[model samples]
Target: MILLDAGTTYAKILNTETNEKTVKKVAELEKTFKADIGTGHNINRFAKQSVNEIIALSYAGKRLIKEKSFTLLDVGSRDAKYVIFENGNFIHSDWNTECGAFTGQAIEILGSYLNLNYNAIEPQKEFITATCGLLGMGHVFDMVASSVEPGIAAARLIKGVCMSMYRFARKPHKIYLTGGLVNNALFVKSMPVETICLDRFTLLEGVLEYAASKKDDINL
Candidate 1:
């Protein structure tokens, strides 16, 4: 079986037969390999079967984690999404970029500006108010210009983003963090509840399942 995650920035192809995975530009659709299932935004462009991102995420989460109920947080490059799963079924799913908060892109840009290195910063009292990435970026510059330490500014900004996510998600008790920020220490610190970080292949796992379902339907 083969699975393809054709995303906007890059496409990830996995050959389940050989356990081989490769990442390439979205435009590199040169029939490199045949896929049994396809997912992500660009899946319809080339994939034989298309799966929604949220559906794939939910399915993958249920299979990998033992928890029957929890909030799945996906902090992506441009936006953040969360899905509530109960009894291995998706209950609620939502995506947001309100005030430019809960986005990995903003955090990355902010970190670069502040010159942050760690996954999470040490405990600090400072907290940024601006949730919008662009606005928060301006706030960082102003804070640094006013003599606030770079690291402190970074921590404050990161914490602010986390707060936005928590509040918007309705302060869930359990959370499973995924997406690119899953490995970031700063992101882990900002969460109020403990989170289990899953591998990046979580969504692909769901795609594989979806492909199997299609095959079963057609008796292939």
Candidate 2:
């Protein structure tokens, strides 16, 4: 079986039989290459079976996280979402599309434009009032124009972005974090709350898990 978590910019693919995983640009995936089970924005276009990203995350959270009560947040290319669980049971979930506009994309483009290495940027105390990625990026540009070092400006933007995500997740004491940002050290460090970064493949794992469970009832 194959599973895919295809986001706006990239696709995380998993071969269940081999337990091998690969990340590829969404544009590079052939139209004919479909997954047995899949989730994410672009998955519907190529997946034989589709699952809601949030539902996939819930399955992953229950399988991966050991905490009885916790918050799991998946900040993807286009948006941010979080699920709250109490005593191992999901209680609430929220997906922030409006204010989270182009968050991951913003970071990627800004880093490329600035030639900034997120792993090297230290989390800073001073951050712009991002409110959202677009507004935050505006602040970054203004700051850079004012002679703020490009790296510093970028760091501030990342911190602001992290803060926005934190606030949206209701500022949990500790977050179970996943998605593209998990690999960005600065983004992880900038998170105002304690954060546990999960593998970027977390969502793919969820898709695989769901496919396994439904194999007996559904043809795949």
Candidate 3:
């Protein structure tokens, strides 16, 4: 079985049989998948193709495992998400409504300007006081020009985001962090509990696992 987790910036494909995953630009997959090409925007186009692929695979007699007991946390360019799973199926999800300094886009943009890698940001030492994305960037720039190290600034930014997600999660369970931001070591380390960084393939693996597990019941 194959699982695909399509996000705003990239797509993750997992081959369950070999437990190997591949990451690629959503646009690249569109040609082979031949699904709705949507607008030129990769995020929208990729997301649409991902959904279509999942549905098509299911209809092709593939067994997909969809577990509901797990919680899936996807942090992306636009927003962050907290999803609950039950019996290999998605039960509910919550997302940040307004754009803020804690968003992935804000982090990446600021990180680039500061010449800081996302993984290099250390959260334990720095304090981030900004309430929104714009203010956050402004504050970061101010610090940067004043000779503050970019690593510290990145840490503060990551800390703020982790705090935001922590507030949204109520139950204590293992969290699976997905999306491009997961590559950051500082951000992953800052997680309150042990976080499972599945790089880009987590969603794909989840989808494939769910599909495979349900084969007997759904005739997939």
Candidate with top lDDT is 2
Ranking by lDDT: 2, 1, 3
lDDT of 2 at 22: 95
Error of 1 at 98 (Å): 7.6
2 or 3, greater by lDDT: 2
Question: What TM-score should be assigned to candidate 3?
Answer: 0.67
The C-alpha local distance difference test score for the whole of candidate 3 amounts to 0.58
Error of 2 at 209 (Å): 2.6
Off by over 4 Å in 1: 8-11, 22-36, 42-48, 97-102, 123-125, 216-220
Q: Is candidate 1 or candidate 3 better by TM-score?
A: 1
User: Can you write out model 2's per-residue Cα lDDT over 1-220, one digit (the tens) per residue?
Assistant: 8888999889999887899989999999998998887899998898888988898898888888888898999998788888989998889899987654788888988898888888988889887766667777888999999999988998988888888888888878999999999999999999998899999899987776776777786578
- Which sections of candidate 3 miss by over 4 Å? 1-3, 15-20, 27-70, 85-92, 129-134, 171-174, 209-220
- What is the lDDT of every predicted structure here? 0.72, 0.87, 0.58
RMSD of each: 3.2, 1.3, 5.9
lDDT per residue as tens, model 3, 1-220: 4455555556666555787767776656855453221111243434333333223222221222233366656676666666665666546667664655247777777777767766544566456756676787777777778887767766776777777666665444666666677887777887766577655554444444444555564332
lDDT of 1: 0.72
Residue 185 miss distance in model 2 (angstroms): 0.5
Candidate ordering by TM-score (highest first) = 2, 1, 3
Q: Residue 216 of candidate 1: its Cα lDDT? A: 62
Error of 2 at 17 (Å): 0.9
